[model samples]
Target chain A: MISALQSVPFESVLAGGLLIGFAALLLFAFNGRIAGVCGITFSLIKHHPTLPSMTWRWLFLGGLVAGTLLYHFLTNTPFPEPPNNSLPLLIGGGLLVGYGTSMGSGCTSGHGVCGIARFSTRSITATACFMAAGIVSLFVFKHLFGWSI
Target chain B: MNQKIIALLAGLLFGAGLAASGMNDSNVVQGFLDVSGDWNPSLMFVMAAALMVTIPGFQYFLRRKPIFAQGFQLPSLKSIDRQLVIGAIIFGAGWGLVGLCPGPAIAALGYLNWEGVVFVLAMLAGAKLRQVQTT
Candidate 1:
């Protein structure tokens, strides 16, 4: 088992801390949004009639892409390599996630971050379900199905 | 300051977390998702660290009267229905198969991982399809 403090990249951890802090600062300073993905996506879908909300969603998502690109260009981090998996599996998995997100009413970001942070009872339940599913899937795929990338 | 701005900021922080934690690394994520292989527990540490930062913020918010908004919105429903079970199963299958969830999948852009690209595209497609199905 990996000890909590032993394996972490300290520099990376600090960077992560700073980044989250920055986000909190931005949210407080600017639009006051909670940076929840599911809620944003849900708002976009459910409140399509509201152009302002829709516009914000697009802008927020754009910022996400822009931020990653900015970091990559600045630091010259190597790109992530492709997983050695079949396209069919990829497509299938994506479909499942879409379906799951709809059924669950939010994605990990919505529930895992904003939901849990606010101590939303619903988020707690959703996060628990998300983690449990992830753990169980790993067991089934690796042990029972004997699947490999 | 509105919720949109706050969300934008939160996303940036969350993205940075995903990147720094090596959660964006396909290999590390795959390791976590792979039980048959050299399973990595670093992901758990990342979660703990995130909680360390977030839990305090949460408590702080609780003490105050919504510094950033009129009031904090909390979800009301708490029943486990068929939708919940089915959704969990599907989500687990996807995570097991792809080793990339939505947050880190987008963050993987920093690494320019092809799998990440594929996963994000598929995830978007999934989201679109879900919209259609619901409507």
Candidate 2:
């Protein structure tokens, strides 16, 4: 019901994207790690590494939290409003996302942003699949189920 | 210690990007997924811009060894498999259902929203379930 031309937030999107790229670049340049949250989370949970090894991951995540807070304070970006969906939907959605990212080995940042930049065929394929599936899922949920999420 | 500091700063920049791009908002994401409805193509611009910087920077920076690391850590596989496809399918469904990916989810929590808390807890549980084995 809407054209993308009107809805696209150009300035913010561009600025934000640059920042994301910078973040990914710095992470790889310095720590040699992909800024993949799911991957990092898995390592934190499953990798029984020593304290020295574990510290960086925790710091990275902590910085994420801090940066978010700083952005809010500096820019006064309003916090996101919660979706008006059923609890079952929320729970199921969260579970699937967590599992899929783990199984797939990356999410948007790793596969979508960083992977595409690297020109990896696997990342390209995975990103395409993620987008296609999301579109189809949204269509089904809205048209067939008549649910407003 | 220096590695930890840089990592944290990297996380901060990433979070800033997510926030600035309005990705922390579930509605914006849902809008993007809603191709049949109110679609927003801002995500495309975000992707392009990110690639513009990273494609050159990441590829170029690697000519030299990383300052803190011996070498650049990157994924090597170029093959497609069932795990990748199935995982993407499930992830896409969940994203469409709630419009919260891993990065944005964490950013939302930075705002201290209780809704984010619930989703994160469920996500954590889902992740931990991987340790379970079925015989």
Candidate 3:
């Protein structure tokens, strides 16, 4: 863990934070959207493929992949080794994330970033709940069940 | 056209930021969540710094209409309801298990890794389940 932190320079993290904020600002200022990834993903599912409104969603998501590609191209950094979780574990985790975000109406970016920025009580509460839940889950999974990361 | 362009650019920047900050790495996120172990505080720093920019930026933007859209399309639901808590708990648990939240998961697809593909498909299925239940 310490090694991971040490591996990614502090400047990169800070710069990334600023870039994220700037990105949020760009979306809000121009499109009046919250820049919530889960919400966008949900909408992509809900709307018909040919819907005009779906255009932006598709573009944004495409951009997400492209941006990562750009990063790799620019830095020549190799992808991190994918975790060795079982198929069942991965499927279960994905299911929880998808369903929970839908029910909760947001995820980390929606609730943790945009919502918190707006100082919404709901966002704050949601963020707290998830953070606590993550902590508990990690402790139980790794410490008790002995799941390796 | 302009709106679409901005959305694409924003998404691009967002993805780049996630990649740069090491948020796309499951190990880093898992390390952060491992409170009872050798906890990594990088995520905290990311959130704090992000808040520093967003708090003020959102405040300024909220005061006026957006440049392209007629009005801000903000979430109207304000109540701290049970659904929100339960859903967040479930999401967090999943996040802890995989250390791959929505944004990072999407960004990681650039690697063309099979894990990212599998997780995303499963996530979509989960979301489909929610849709079925509601509708």
Best by lDDT: 3
List model 3 lDDT by residue over A1-149, tens digit each. 37643357788788778878888888988899998998898888873556888999989989988887787789886776675678899999999999999999999989998999999999999999999998998899889999874
Cα lDDT, model 1, residue A39: 53
Span of ten consecutive residues with least summed lDDT in model 1 chain B: B65-74
DockQ score for candidate 1: 0.43
Please say which candidate is ahead in lDDT: 1 or 3: 3
**Per-prediction TM-score to the true structure, in the order listed:** 0.80, 0.93, 0.97
Question: Which of 2 and 3 is ahead in DockQ?
Answer: 3
Ranking by lDDT: 3, 2, 1
Candidate with more favorable, higher TM-score: 1 or 3: 3
Across residues B3-97, which tens digit of lDDT does each residue of candidate 1 receive?
65656656665665666666665556656655555666666666556656666666666555565566545556676676766675677667767
Q: Give the top-scoring candidate (DockQ).
A: 3
Best-to-worst TM-score order: 3, 2, 1
Question: Which pairs clash in model 2?
Answer: none
Task: Name the runs in model 2 displaced over 4 angstroms.
Answer: A1-8, A47-49, B133-135
**Candidate 2, residues B1-135: lDDT per residue as tens digits?**
778888989999988888888777787888888888778767777888899998998778767778888887787766889888888888888888888888888777877766787887787777777544210
**What are the chain A TM-scores of the candidates, in order?**
0.78, 0.89, 0.92
Residue range A1-149, candidate 2, lDDT tens digits: 65432353679889999999999989888888888877776667663556777788888777777887788789876666775567888888889888888777788999988887777887888889888888888889976798977
User: Local error of candidate 1 at A39, Å?
Assistant: 3.6
